[model samples]
Target chain A: MSAHATTEHAYVPGEIAKPNTAWIWKTFWVLVIITAIEFAIAFALTSPDWRTFRNSIFIVLTILKAFFIVGEFMHLKHEVKSLIWTVLIPTSLLVWLVVALVTEGSFIGETLSHMFSS
Target chain B: MAHSTTLESSSTPIYADAPRTGTWDGGNEPFKASYGKLMMWFFLLSDAFTFGAFLTAYGMIRHKHGVFVGTADKFFFSTAHWPIPEKVFNGFPGLHGMDLPLAFVALMTMILIFSSVTMVLAVEAGHRMDKADVQKWLLWTILFGAMFLSSQAWEWSHFIGGSEKGLLMADGSVMHGANLATNEYGPPLFADLFFFITGFHGTHVFSGVCLLVWCFIATTNGTFEKRGHYEMVEKIGLYWHFVDLVWVFVFTFFYLV
Candidate 1:
């Protein structure tokens, strides 16, 4: 069979079409806007409690950016549902692991600090 | 009559050299089964584990060492007493007397991020069978990767070259201001961990540059024309994006946190 013939056999259900450039461009601009906001939060904010506020915002925005890249740019949305879930499930688990480990580790360190210093 | 027919069929024995009808080969799922792309995914998965292990080690070390003196308490509710990332990374040639905070490293981050964008564009172009766009974007990606690597090298040299005061030593190992064996910028294990982790990442980037160069050459020579597809570009895209994603974690854990 010809190379083009294989498109008919693709595991994906929808038409295996190229992504819309205009939509991609729009998404890119949105990502840029979000990044700019992140920089502003990191640099411009001067509140005594800014770190907590900024960190929360940063994490949320980063997740959003990652979702866009994976779902849209990488065309994971068009793939078989099983494949999407297979990738996403593990990724989510890993993210959770990183957060938990880092937080717990910090707490332990803090406790150690108090123990040694006192 | 049935016996006679069977005897004739057996006598007319099929040739051993005849090809099978449903054999697995190049034609099976041709569009989606590019070897290069498959290899890329495998490479990415392995690379992800490496980064995971490094970050986990970092966490373990941080757990033991506690936080840096100026960073831990001062960094939570307020950014006030936080150890400035910029102050730690402000070295640049011809920019003497200027105290730039994380400026160069930030630029390097942008370079890697933008390179990822270009890599995706190249993959997209490949899908459209636009060889020219593939070549163009691949070249851009290569340039970005090279630039980022150079920036990282400079950062490392600045770090190891030491400041005017030099690294304070106690008991023959570098000690922080508080006279503690380790402080939050990560334990002494931190300096070692940082070098190893980033060095491994830099090696990947260097390899990526080589791959991009190869891909560029292949595109120019119309290798995909005969094959009638661009799966190689997609494969490389996976590797490039993985690098960028790893950096996001590094920036957060090592710099922000």
Candidate 2:
């Protein structure tokens, strides 16, 4: 194949020939703002009953961070829609498994401790 | 005759390098595979599984232990026996003798995350065919990565460099928190597990630093420039971002929980 022809054919349809740098930078700044908020929440909050609120906030922020990292940084957003789903679904499953296992494991530990003391 | 002439005039140009008709879906498919990117995705998938297993095992052990260690009464902050993560990681610049609490680790986390950003920037620069920007961002990423590794090294030293037992005795055997057989913190197993898990993570950071350094040198040497694409930066970005992502879970499970 001729070099020019090869180069021309390399352009995949629906792919942005050039990404918008301004949009990416804007998103990046937004992420930075969220991170600052996270640090603030981590340090400044003093409520005795803040655990639930804090955890929920952290989880939500973290998911948002993950979305930007995957969609923008990883360029997954630019890929085929099917491929994006392929990656996200399995990742969601793995996250669920981690939470479930950690909860069950902690429960067992508590039970064993109680039994030993009794 | 008129229809045929119009059709001939408007026919699309078929390049020699283009895949034969029917080889790919219709005319445009979104999922294009280059060898490197495909491999990166697969590697990331496997790594995800490994992390999931480790975290699951951690959960099991934590549950089985039942009692928290290093509570405020026994150590500092929080009533739970689980060591206060902030207290355990409170090293800070010019704050000697002050228990700053999770300050250093938080800083390290920021540094690593920022490096991930730089890595993506490098990949973006590559997509734009801007060699100088790619080089600049990759250098920044490498510097950030090195700073993180150095910080981790300091953290590890602080962890292991506390007063050594039996130093004056005839046999200078260093005693860790406890042996692997029996002790508080869930039968000494928890300590071993902690060391193994964090140590493994440290090794990954160490190796990642080396890879980043290698990539930096290659970029400086104009390797990516000659290759005509910055996909290599994107490839490393995947690995770098994965490291950062894993640390998120580690922080949640090991520190927050």
Judging by TM-score against the true structure, name the best candidate.
2
Please give the TM-score that candidate 2 achieves against the real structure. Answer: 0.76
Q: B158-252 in candidate 2: lDDT tens per residue? A: 65443223122224443333334432222455556667666777777777778877887887887966665556777888888878777766766
TM-score of chain A of each: 0.75, 0.76
lDDT of 1 at B16: 41
**B238 Cα displacement, candidate 2 (Å):** 1.7
Q: What tens-digit string does per-residue lDDT give for candidate 2 at A1-118?
A: 1122125225343344554467667767866787777768777663436756876787788778777777777778887777777777887787778678768877776675677685
Where does candidate 1 chain B have its weakest 10-residue lDDT segment? B72-81
Tell me the tens digit of each residue's lDDT in model 1 across A9-112: 34233335564367566667766676667666666654445656766777787777777766666666666675567566666666767778777777776786
Per-prediction TM-score, please? 0.75, 0.76
